[model samples]
Target: MESDMTAALIRPVAIKLDEVTKARVKRLAEARHRTSHWLMREAITQYVDREEKREAFRQDTLRAWDEYRSTGLHVRADEADAWLAELEQGKDIEPPPCHK
Candidate 1:
């Protein structure tokens, strides 16, 4: 099934690993009963997943800050903390509405 995918769908990369690192990769791959290529793919997948989440968080924070500056409406840290505490206590409380 994987081979059925078009070449355009998968880009190949060339990596030059040091001799030690290459041996380590082989050993680790063998321990997991997987090929070094599979391990490399997994590593890249995880890196992309983590970095994408961080990028999204940064964009969201910037957007929220912009909105707050434009509207002058915000929630106090104490209010937010109290709401969070209620959540920790398993209370079904709604979040406080934001206001100027």
Candidate 2:
């Protein structure tokens, strides 16, 4: 199921890299015992993962701002105190849910 999910999200695109970059990538792949294509895919995946994380963070910040705006008038001092306390206590904070 996880494999299918990953496969569904990936699409192939052909690109032309500079000759020097292509040679560097080839050498890197050889050192890592992987094909050039595999190395390229790994690089692309890392780039995409970084971009997705940034986008998710931006969305979460926007959502938090929106929530704050809507509830500012009704927010309780105790609630704010409790949230700060939780943060100071070093409790684990869950990451935002992943979106397709």
Candidate 3:
């Protein structure tokens, strides 16, 4: 278990923060009873996670658009609207299938 925890340890990289941001991080770390280093790590982890998700979504959207342009396959708007409205009304609804 200790070895597993050691494997999970992150290597440090140097970063420079402006005075205000450093002060804010210190304050929050004190409030949470944690070190500034731990707070910075958490902040970096969360930011990377969010940005990675956004990048993935962007890539998926680009692939979808290319597929649409190539095959001209898509779901119609009215059918999608009806399906969503049913879901909004507390009904179990499968999505309208994509079609060419």
Candidate 4:
């Protein structure tokens, strides 16, 4: 599933597309100096990678929400903003303490 693993072992896979979409893929492949197979593989790989990241973020958000509901401990928006601003200015510091 790594995008740069072209030289590794591979297998043949088939997909069916409408004629118009097939033509578009062909044209784009030619324009990009790549084969249609390569284009499709790249697209699928990127889609999977992006979806995995999104799912991980969703899970993390749910976990955080649950923890907040349990403890009611959180940082204020202004405090977070000031901490981030300090980091943006090249200052390394810990995040503001979370409290009720």
Query: Which prediction has the highest lDDT against the true structure?
Result: 4
Each model's backbone clash number: 0, 0, 0, 0
For model 4, how does the per-residue alpha-carbon lDDT over 1-100 read when each residue is reduced to its tens digit? 5765864667787889999999999999999999999999999999999999999999999999999999999999999999999999999999999999
TM-score of 3: 0.82
Residue 88 error, candidate 1, Å: 1.8
Candidate 1 residue-wise lDDT, 4-81, digit = tens: 677559878899999999999999999999999999889889999999999999999999999999999988899999
lDDT of 4 at 53: 100
Q: State the C-alpha lDDT per candidate.
A: 0.94, 0.83, 0.94, 0.95
1-100 per-residue lDDT for model 2 (tens digits):
9999999998888999999999999999999999999999889889999999999999999997887677664446676667677778997654333222
lDDT of 3: 0.94
For model 3, the superposed segments whose C-alpha errors exceed 4 Å read 1-9, 97-99
lDDT of 3 by residue, 1-100 (tens): 9988987895669999999999999999999999999998899889999999999999999999999999998999999999999999999979998897
TM-score of each: 0.85, 0.60, 0.82, 0.87
Give candidate 3's root-mean-square deviation (CA, Å): 2.2
At residue 63, give the lDDT of candidate 4.
Answer: 100
Give candidate 1's whole-model lDDT.
Answer: 0.94
Worst 10 residues of 4 by lDDT: 1-10
Runs in model 4 deviating more than 4 A are 1-9
C-alpha RMSD in Å of predicted model 2 compared with the true structure: 8.1
Candidate 1 vs candidate 4: the TM-score winner is 4
Determine which window of 10 residues in candidate 1 has minimal summed lDDT. Answer: 1-10
